[model samples]
Target: MATEVLFYHLTSQPLEAVLPGLLMKCLERDWTVVVQCGSRERVEALDAHLWAFSDDSFLPHGTAADDHPEHQPVYLTDGPDNPNGAVIRFLVDRAVPGSIEGYARIVLLFDGQDPEALAEARGHWKSLKAQGAEVTYWQQKPNGGWERKA
Candidate 1:
């Protein structure tokens, strides 16, 4: 099966607000997820954010250094390693995956405010399409909802 590649253009909301919900959706489907960022600092910050993103909600996640990757429902890292055997991979903050295959879905979330991020996302879309992956582009609407653009 071809990997489903999704590009999320962050405009109305920051990743902190959007990511938790997406992760929750994956978890509801009984799918483990791996979120990869560009730097350790970013990954650490995300680890903290996921813990306190909502007062009523909790996301079961941990970093690579935390160990027990197999126990975590969601894993966060800066490297291109999938220790948890996640079915879905989220590439955030311009993080590029070494390979898109094997995963059931691959999500690329980039900031619309950054020109460089947008350019990188475009290149990724083209490359993934060329690899025969099913690609979808989502744009954040003014109401903070996402709309499928392509």
Candidate 2:
């Protein structure tokens, strides 16, 4: 199946407040997720954040530094490798995906307040569109839900 690429422009909330919900949705669908970041610092920060982000619960995830990455429902990395065999991949921290094949979904979540992130996302959209890829853009609504804009 062709991979569906989604660009999520985060306007109403920051990533910390928004990511967990999306990951939960993917988990609900029984899809292992790979969240690729731009740096090891980000990997570490997310590793800790996912653990303490929730008041009553936290998303079960691990990183390459973990003993068993393959068993983690959500695997965090800064590379192109899919250690957990994730069907849905998330590209964050301005991390660009190397390839879009062999996945059910490719989600790019960018900060709407960052000019550079916005520009980079636009570039990705144009490049992917030119390649005849199935791409769509979604914006965060005031209510913190997603609204498809393209």
Candidate 3:
């Protein structure tokens, strides 16, 4: 079974340089990486690159009900009012039994602030971990980016 790792970083800093390296690692291990970025354009661009790397890779956006692959990298928008709304629901649903039963692991990434978003995400993380799923978290700085709040 693949180890589930939720690698998330929320900062004003662009993850363009960092993401490729991370993806490369996942590819090496043949791990299914579920990534969520706040910016649509950025995620779209990343998706394009991902497709170039792996034809089997898929990036579907928006709610699962309306989710359809658009080109490559899957990007989702958690609007101010809807943060942790659709994506969280989708992950929780997928993590449930039978849906993605064979999935060795589940990973969730999100902006680590916005009390509402983090609260909801934390709940899901805790529940999954309690069920024996390895849970990990990284929080970004609240002032401007995901830096340590100190």
Candidate 1 Cα lDDT to native: 0.92
TM of each candidate vs. truth:
0.97, 0.96, 0.44
lDDT comparison, 2 vs 3, better candidate: 2
Candidate 1 lDDT over residue span 31-111, tens digit each: 999999989999999999998989898899988779799889999999988889998999998898569879999999999
Superposed model 3: Cα runs more than 4 Å off: 1-9, 12-18, 32-46, 49-100, 140-150
Q: Per-residue alpha-carbon lDDT of model 3 for 1-150, expressed as tens digits?
A: 433535354544334434555555554664433454444554456556544544565333332223443322333332222222222211311122212234454444444445665566667666666666555665545454333221
Estimate, for each residue in 1-150, the C-alpha lDDT of model 2 and write its tens digit. Answer: 567899999998999899999999999999999999989999899999999997999999998878888899999999998988999999999998778878889999999999999999999998877766699999999999999999
Judged by TM-score relative to the true structure, which candidate is superior, 2 or 3? 2
The lDDT per prediction is 0.92, 0.92, 0.42
RMSD of each: 0.8, 1.0, 9.4
